[model samples]
Target chain A: MTVSIVVVSHSENIADGAAELAAQMAPDVLVLTAGGTADGRIGTSLEKVLAALDHAAGGDGTVILTDLGSAVMTAESALEFAEDPAGVLLADAPLVEGLVAASVAAQGGADVQAVKRAAEAVRGPSQNSGPPPQREVSEGSVTGQGPDFTGDFELINQAGMHARPAAKIAGGLSALDAEVTVNGVDGASMTALMTLAAGKGSVLHVEARGVDAERAVNYVGGLVQAGFGEP
Target chain B: MVLDVNWAVKWLTLCAQAMAEHRVELIELDRAIGDSDHGENMDRGFQAVLDKLAEAPPATPGAALKLAAMTLMSKVGGAAGPLYGTAFLRAAGTMGDAAEIDPAGWAAAVSAARDGIVARGKAEPGDKTMVDAWAPAADAAKAAADTGGPEVLSVLVAAAEAAEAGAVATDPLVARKGRASYLGERSAGHRDPGAASSALILRAAVGAAA
Candidate 1:
């Protein structure tokens, strides 16, 4: 079963709208909302959050994304009182962006931990200054340290490296056990990929290292070569 | 006097009365630095607690506190909901299923409640938040209980007085946490609504004990 997502926000409209937007990118993923108090006021409710956690318990796992301060506290309180807290995780990421990234990863069949990583990876350059350090290959390598797999592919679609294509590449790669980078930004991050702004005919430099490194490179190559199945 | 379920019920009822009595004053205090909903939220939350207590009369002091915790977290539509909810819940955890709480036990519960608020809110004593009141109140309760006396009323009175003084001490400090922090220098010269409400809650405990 796919991992479910819960959105916690002080404003009911914000939670509902964020879930709605994430649902568009990952239609198969279940995104629930627990926002506002029971009396329809503008604040989080532990009961509402606990109810959402209970509803999401049937899935493989649940990831919680919250907005503002008290929302996070309410989510934490719900987890403390949850029947199965082990299956629920809280992502310390922005609500909208993190929710979308998490939904996309869940749609790609990522497990609970991977889905959380997908959401947290959305942190902008300000939070994460640079690309992750390249992993050193243990096996006999001519170079002292290098990526296990590397590839370069040109963007062919008219839209180039847009939201959908980036989401596809990032979403698919997040499920893989690999550290990947396209150009200079994190490949598993949708927001990072979008920042590249690589237009049609621009080449994407890919580097990967891990058990699924080769598979990650090929996955990106396949998506780019086929124009992400878009015009 | 034994701190039991009856005392807990009386404490919460007095808390509701206090909130209602000082609602407008709390709103004014919050308006100076915060979102101005502290009074309304606390009033609504305690009223809900009162209703829950009526519907299901708790068997023990801990049970009553647990009921109040859940109700506050559900009905209070603000940061205070989670903050006070966590405090009460943690305090209840310390009480366990015991029918009566000794002076030392009550003091430990107060300390646990304060710790919970600090952990949940991540605020320090001088942050101009509820911790300002709770921290000193907890300390006073522990000190009073440490005297090895069976006088529970003395411990409650000490905690309540310390909380009241701590809340007043927040008047001139610049807020370092919560919505008031956004105001920067403008937040000074104003009492923190959270601290005020915290004092009121502690004072109600003393009133119940009396």
Candidate 2:
């Protein structure tokens, strides 16, 4: 079973909307919402958060994403009061993007820690701008310490490295044993991959290591070649 | 006299009374620098605590505090909910299963509660938040408890008085945290609503002991 997700927000609509948006990308993942007071006011409630945590418990694990200050405090208070805080984690990231990333990771069967990482990764370098993350290997013999496997694929789809494409690549890579980097960014990180902004016809330099190295390369190659089933 | 479960219950009951008595004043203070919900939230939270206490009265002081912590966290519906909840929860942890609290226990409990507030709110003494009141109160309680022939009542009074003074001291300071901080220099000359509520709560502890 995949890890469950809880969205905490001061506005009920915000929590429900964020959960709804995430569920679209991760149909099988459990994304619960704990927003607003029990009286339906605009504030976080510890009881509601506790109830959501209780529901999310006993799954593979649970990752919580919160919006604003009091929501974070309420989530922390719930964690403190929880019967077992072992598998529960609170991600310090923007609520909507973090929830979507976490939900996608969970749907791909990532562990709780990985799910938290995915959520937090949303806050990394802006996806569509900025210089790529510095790679340990230099350009030439970058292959000397090179990835176990490498492949170059052209983006076939009209809309290139957008959120959906990035999510697909990231979701698939997270389940693999390989550590992959796409065009200098962490391959399993959706936001990082989207940062590549490799639009249509752009060549994506894919590299991978670990036991699933070849499979990871083939996975990205297949997705890119297929245009991620998009136009 | 020993501060026992009965004392805890009475303290909470008096807290509810204090909240009711000072609700409008807190609301006015918050209106100057916050969302104006402090009094309403505190009153609602303590009333819920009273209801919970009636539903299942606790046998130990710690148990009573834990109950209060949960209720306030659940019902207060604001930052104060978790802030005060953590404070009470940590204090309860210090009390453990003991039926009564001595001067030292009171000192420890107050300090733990203050630390919990700091951890949860990430506020410092001069932040013009509730920490302004709690920090001095904790120090004063500890100092009173440290003196030879320390009396529990003396420790409680010291905390209450120090907290009251701390609350008063916030009136001229610029807020560095919470909603009041948003106002920048304008926040000065207004008493921090949280500090005021905290002072009231601490004063109620003295009333309960008396």
lDDT of each: 0.91, 0.91
Give model 2's clash tally: 2
The sequence of per-residue lDDT tens digits that candidate 2 reaches over residues B115-160 is: 9999999999998999999999999999999993646999999999
User: TM-score of each candidate?
Assistant: 0.95, 0.92
On lDDT, the candidate that comes out on top is 1
Chain A TM-scores of each predicted structure, in the order given, are 0.90, 0.89
Q: Model 2 over residues A1-231: C-alpha lDDT tens digits? A: 899999999899999999999989999999989989999988889989989999999999999999988788899999887988999999888998899888888888788888888888888856424564333443333344768899999999999999999999998887777679899898988888887888999999998977778999999999999999999
Candidate 2, position B188, lDDT? 96
Model 1 ranges with Cα > 4 A deviation: A125-144
Instruction: Let me know the TM-score candidate 1 reaches against the reference structure.
Output: 0.95
lDDT of 1 at B85: 96
For model 1, residues B34-131, the per-residue Cα lDDT tens digits are: 88999999999999999999999999999999999989988897899989999999999999999999889889999999999999999999999999
Tens-digit per-residue lDDT, A1-231, candidate 1: 799999999999999999999989999998999988887888888889988888899889999999998898888888878999999999989899999999989988888988887788888656744574454554644342778899999999999988899889888988887788999788988888999999999999999877788999999999999999889
